[model samples]
Target: MAVDAARDGVRSRAPARERLRAGGRISRAARYLFFGAVLGYFCIPMAAVLIYSFATRWTANVLPDGYTLDWWQATVSNPRIQSAFSTSMALATLTAFIDIAVVVPAAYWSRVRNARIRHVIEVAAAVPFALPYVVIAFGLMQFSGVVAPQFQGTFVLLVAGHAAIAFPFVYWAVDGAMAAAGIERLSETAEACGASPMQIVRLVVIPNISSGLVTGGLLSFAASFGEFAMAQIIGRGLDTVPLWSAEMIRSYSDTAGSYNRLAVVTLLTFAVLFVLSAVVVYWNRGQTVRLLPGAGASDEGGRR
Candidate 1:
């Protein structure tokens, strides 16, 4: 390997050090600009939501005329807003629990069974993802109308719909992480060493994908939280936050105060999720060893 490296080094047009030094400046600049553009695009919506939530006045101007906490106070004080927020939270928490159980085992089993089958499973997971929310919600509602009338208007219907949308996120996210990092080998090796399949999965697979899992769950939660179509179509009167906000906008244009209050609620939801996502990212980075392929795969029980 050393000799091959030396031969390859000598055959090159320029010394690697000089070539790297000469071209790195242009490459780095391109990378910076690419990332800066992406970041700016993400910041725009968030900035709008935050600024408008606090903005005391609005007009034809591009920016808010002023800012205040009246929106926050009104949002918090409104019992309707509180009810909607609570509903969203409950729905999200339920989705997270359902996702964690289903996604990991399915991903691991798909990997264990066949990679081509894995592709099929992934497609199923993502099929709903590609569809517009309203299209799927209407389909679900129509299907439910014929197949199961009992679920027409209830929290159960909302959760199932939310899970359908959120499932794609959790499945793909953790599945991608596991596939990229040889997580199956970790589990396979564990089971070979007298570890039960359940133990191997619980201790090894879960730890490695914990961050990805949580991140996926968070994405699912956020997706469910802001969901408008599912709730409108089939959630009945159990208004999730987004449905409530949309109704407020439609019903009360004369009531800008209500709009402001909805904006404040949205801002708060964003803040909480943003903080949780940051913490998950930070925690994973700090525990960096497990991220490497097979980095923490071995154990006292030999290769477990």
Candidate 2:
């Protein structure tokens, strides 16, 4: 009787233990489910875009049927598409170079010569981010008439607008690089070695912060490439890639292959941006190893 009573008591306690374990497992499963749901929510759209790019038919179907490259071929063969692409590339390239030319010197000067003015300039850079594109577009339109009355509706205005909007990105990138590489201290050391200011910048500063320059350049290029509002407003007749894409999408009927061209163009842009991002990642990884001679070795030693 005593043995049976002890066995019954153990059996009674087992449910409580199992219940606690089950509750923990349920909580963990719920967490995973929630995160998975969020991931799927964001990914479905991009995946749909990718699928639609190659899809011959998608209507009334859960998945696209009959993949084809015809849309990609058509989009590429269009002369207007080519011109718009060229305009976007040219504008982006110019903006990137301009950003490097201006931000590099300006950031270095702010760090080495005057720290107080950095705040003011940084705030100025944020103007594009703080204000809406419509507001900036209106302001630019108004000022262009006063500054260069004949320059309105020109490609120069478009480039200038893109550069202005992209300034913050370039400035922030270069500034971050300067801070990370301790450029001010490096500059001082170079000065102590009898190097001129320009020499210090050209040699020590530029080499150390090359990653930042590339990042800023890529970001500027991407921003300029995709910018629509300013292009539509300031550019007027200038049909950059984004404007062209927008026009095409707007005019597209509910036909089977109409969206395919737009999707292909979008995918192309995405691929370019993705490649640039990958390059930046690769550079950053290599940079950590190359920044100082034996720097990696010393880090390993310190960790040990």
The model with the greatest lDDT is 2
For model 1, residues 1-304, the per-residue Cα lDDT tens digits are 5433223221234554554233344455655676698999999888887887887777568888788888787778788878888888999889877877877787888887567766776567655656788888888888999999888978888788888778766776677578667887887788788898789887888888876787678767777877788888888778778787787777776345666776777778778768766765675665433322223222112322
Q: lDDT, candidate 2, residue 18?
A: 61
C-alpha TM-score for every candidate: 0.73, 0.82
lDDT of each: 0.72, 0.79
Q: What lDDT tens digits, residue by residue, belong to model 2 across residues 1-304?
A: 5433222221123463463223344455665676698999988888988998888888888888789888889889989888988999999999999878988988898999988768877678658867888789878988998888788888998898888888777776677688889998999999999999889988999999887888788878888888888988888888898888788788867474668888988888888878876776677774433222223234346422
Candidate 1 vs. true structure, TM-score = 0.73
Task: Give me the runs in candidate 1 sitting further than 4 Å from their true place.
Answer: 1-68, 114-117, 252-256, 280-304
**Model 1 lDDT, full chain set:** 0.72
Model 2 worst lDDT run, 10 consecutive residues: 3-12
